[model samples]
Target: MEDHTAGHNKEKRYECDVCGKAWQQPYLLKIHRRVHTGERPYVCSICDKSFMRTQELKKHRRLHSGEKPYGCSTCGKRFARLSGLWVHRPVHSSERPYTCSDCGKGFKLSTDLKVHRRLHTGERPYTCSDCGKGFTRSTSLLEHRHTHTGERPYTCSQCGEGYIRAKSLRAHQRTHTGERPFICAKCGKSYTRSTSLREHQCTHTGECPYTCAQCGKGFTRSTRLLSHQRVHTGDRPVPSTVCGGGLAMASHVLSHQRVHTSGQPYDCPYCGEAFDSSRELRQHRRAHAGEQMLPLQQTFQEHAGAAGAPADTHQRVTL
Candidate 1:
């Protein structure tokens, strides 16, 4: 009754000197002080992972047990925790109460809006202790630490392949299932990933959003744009292991290594011809289709002359 009266009266008697955060109960204050002290009392027996709270340790155990007790009332989607289900509930509705002042982007939760605002402000509160890399979120910082520790917790049951992230494991599982969930609305082409679908849609719309500042060459993807920029700068970050030759892209290094070994691993389905690289195999396939093939360097040279050309006018290069 006294605890209820303290909460009802908004009287936080127990206060933390470290962060000046007050709690109604002494036990609640003790739990809150763990954040500042970096103390984790609860430990998972399965993974030997430690948590500050017993409830958090109980939730972490669900990952090993695969126990999803919380179910969404709308879509019947199951979650390990009630907070996950609460976060997902907004997805069924169009309502986004939280709005960003900088970008005018709407989010379902105020916490999401706060995170989105960090992008505009260039505020990265979380920092890695090893490499000193900064991230906008604590989760990203935690993931970055895996690189130093080489800890891949997520694993595939079929292939025994391990991944640092759960999302990467889920995407890899799609290859075995042959699940192309994302579909192109115009051409009806399907892809395993949503980003692949968005890149494919750019081909239909002729949208080359990523443009080169030097030659004004537009590319459908930022990766392609970065590769093209390397051509102008003569910046070959990837080095060939065999000859110690610098290559613009990592794929080029693989192709270069095959030259030393005289290896032709990529075989053509149409013809019995083999190529050292997948790019060569793809270009060779176009020959069977009777499609006019333009040399990659020639295409780049031609586009380089036409500076500030319209995005629609830029030829799409599949690299």
Candidate 2:
């Protein structure tokens, strides 16, 4: 009765020194301290797994026993915990009580609405300790930590290829199954992933959402825009291992390396002609297709004109 009175009166007498968490009961405070001390008093006899609380141990035991005590009244779905039933209850109903003020988005759960609000607020509460990278969600931050640890928990059974995320593994498995689930409504083209389908849809819309600040050049993808910006910035992030020469792109490094070894790796199937790089090979293939190939200077002049820049604006005679 005293415990009930204390809880009803909103009185928390027991407080932890470490985290300053108040509890109505002394025993509850003792259990809370175990979280800071890393002490697990309750042990599962079957699995030998330890838990901070006895209730957690009881929940863990249900996994081995295959016991689900909680049941939904709507769909008759069984759950091991009461919290799971509470979370599942909303799925049966079309009602969304929790609404976001900013985006006018509705969510069934308040916790989900709170996370969605962070997107509008630009609030990244979760941060990485390794590289100091910030993430909007805790799950995203947890996935980012796997990069530093080099852990790929989700693996493909057929090909033995590992991925950091389960979604990536599922997407890669489609390659083996030949499943293209995501289809474009415009062209009726299919893709393994939804992101690829969205990118392809941009071609039909002719929406160049990503634009370069320097040249005013537009691109369908953000990666293409970033690559175009590097041309203006002269940001040679990739360096040649052979000659230590700075190259604008990582793909260009292979061609630059061939200059030192005099290796013509790319070969034309039509004329049996070998080239140092894939770019030259592609140009060689255009000739075989009877396509009029423009000279290097003329091509550069046309590109400069499209970019609203003079032909001699970036000309440099390398000695």
Candidate 3:
């Protein structure tokens, strides 16, 4: 009798010397070696996220550029990739041809049913190296690794603010653009992000899920609870990038770092005035539009003094 398992192993065309892993293709073997070599040649120009393959990098670039080349003929709604358009096609029709044996859930796409089966089988193919958190999707695992590495690839070109997720960068960019896309159905007020709209919606519902143990104070958002606890514990976790140990919120930290970096990247299109951050630029615009505004951050004034004067002097002398 012939040993079939050994024969299958012998059939593998390419093998890695370091790990002794065999692959059917030479290109696959070359890509597998990158895991050991720590070589990521394909870099995203929009952010700094690196990829092992050229195709993976190309797919990622569409997220930043918002390019949906694949369009559906039935509805004309577009997607970044062909696979997305294929997945979307089932939604228009009543036909759900693929059925999951485990839970009897019918899906239009075979891929969707395959993913749903993983939930029943408890098979998570994607995993994190740091904490070993398993996710079904590779994209979710890629986003999860950023928390462990502190690798914020997506950055705001407006204020040099770094963000771990592209979606966060998009939301932050809206602030610079003065875009209020997320509108409240109840109050008719608009917000830059959906999270802000959700938090505001909770106010109307009177949903106080987050409760403080110290004073029994209830809050809508966990961040509001953390801020309230700061008054009691005096634990300001967010550290300042400008001066050491001058802890504040993440928003305030970026606003403060402008003085250190001398970054007045936000340029007014109306009057060509430059400001340190988007908030500052917004206030400056309001002045130009003849609107009443409040005082600017005190840190902006403190910069006019010695600690900040050098950066201003340098920019003035250079520009």
Candidate 4:
């Protein structure tokens, strides 16, 4: 009779019924069957988290042990599993295989495509238990929970300002470093944020995707759409502390606060009077230059869906 437990050089006898992938052992083929059956047989003793395969459970246990054995040959970056190293390969190759059907954007991984699809669908699956606010990803919801808990894990090295997310801290650092990486293709204006650059591009294309349902007025920013809707609804939720005047967007509240700060650097060349933002300065300068105010630069959101930030709040603009 043949030696039943010879060695690793055994013949590939077991074949998967779904994909036709062959393995050396019967138990290995049974574990592979979980790909089709959605079976998680291996359970972690520490967290009780189930995994489809024993190897997967072993890799996941590294989360508790803080062990990352797989190291990238190129960058020396560590990962818990070999599959992570496989996914990291595309980062060096500049290869993006996954494409979004809605926007025709490319991503390196299918998981990224899944997240990007939510932007088009407006589907926020991850929700905050505290406020019932929805987020596209769990990471966003995790960062948002910091507003309630008063947690600032990411801190700036220069000015020591704390942020809940690393991305926010990176963006805030740009204010000090003057790192405007995102450049407008049309106007040559650079912005620290890609969203700001895209918003600037809309001026060249005149593409206002956001439109008011009541008045049919087109706006480039979603914040402006929220502000415009208040006119129809007659809602004034955000109130100014200096005056009893209602504010629509957080930008209005900031601009109103400037009336009290008295340290405005943006002074009019024509009148020597100061204003808070460039938009206000330009509007004031237009009067002296005998030029009509364009009413441009509409997007003004102070805090987007934050605890203290004005969300769905209307400001009563007194004419």
Best by TM-score: 1
In order of lDDT, best first, we have 1, 2, 3, 4
For candidate 1, lDDT tens digit of each residue in 8-108? 89978899998888888899999998888999989999889999999899999999999999999998999999999998999888999999887587999
Off by over 4 Å in 3: 1-66, 70-78, 82-165, 215-217, 246-251, 258-319
Better of 1 and 4 by lDDT: 1
Q: List clash counts for every candidate, in order.
A: 0, 0, 0, 2
Predicted structure 3: lDDT: 0.68
lDDT of each: 0.69, 0.68, 0.68, 0.67
Q: Whose lDDT is greatest here?
A: 1
How far does residue 60 in candidate 4 sit from its true spot (Å)? 12
Comparison by TM-score, 1 against 3, better one = 1
| Cα error, candidate 1, residue 223 (Å) | 5.5
* Every candidate's CA RMSD: 9.7, 10.8, 12.5, 10.1
Per-model TM values vs. the true structure: 0.60, 0.47, 0.42, 0.48
lDDT for each residue of candidate 3 in 251-294, tens digit (9 for 90 to 100):
34444455455556554322234576677766664643233222
lDDT of each residue in 85-176, candidate 4, tens digit only: 99887777777889999878799989989988887898999998986877888997888787557678989999887777788788889999
Ranking by TM-score: 1, 4, 2, 3
Q: Looking at candidate 2, what is the lDDT of residue 128? A: 90
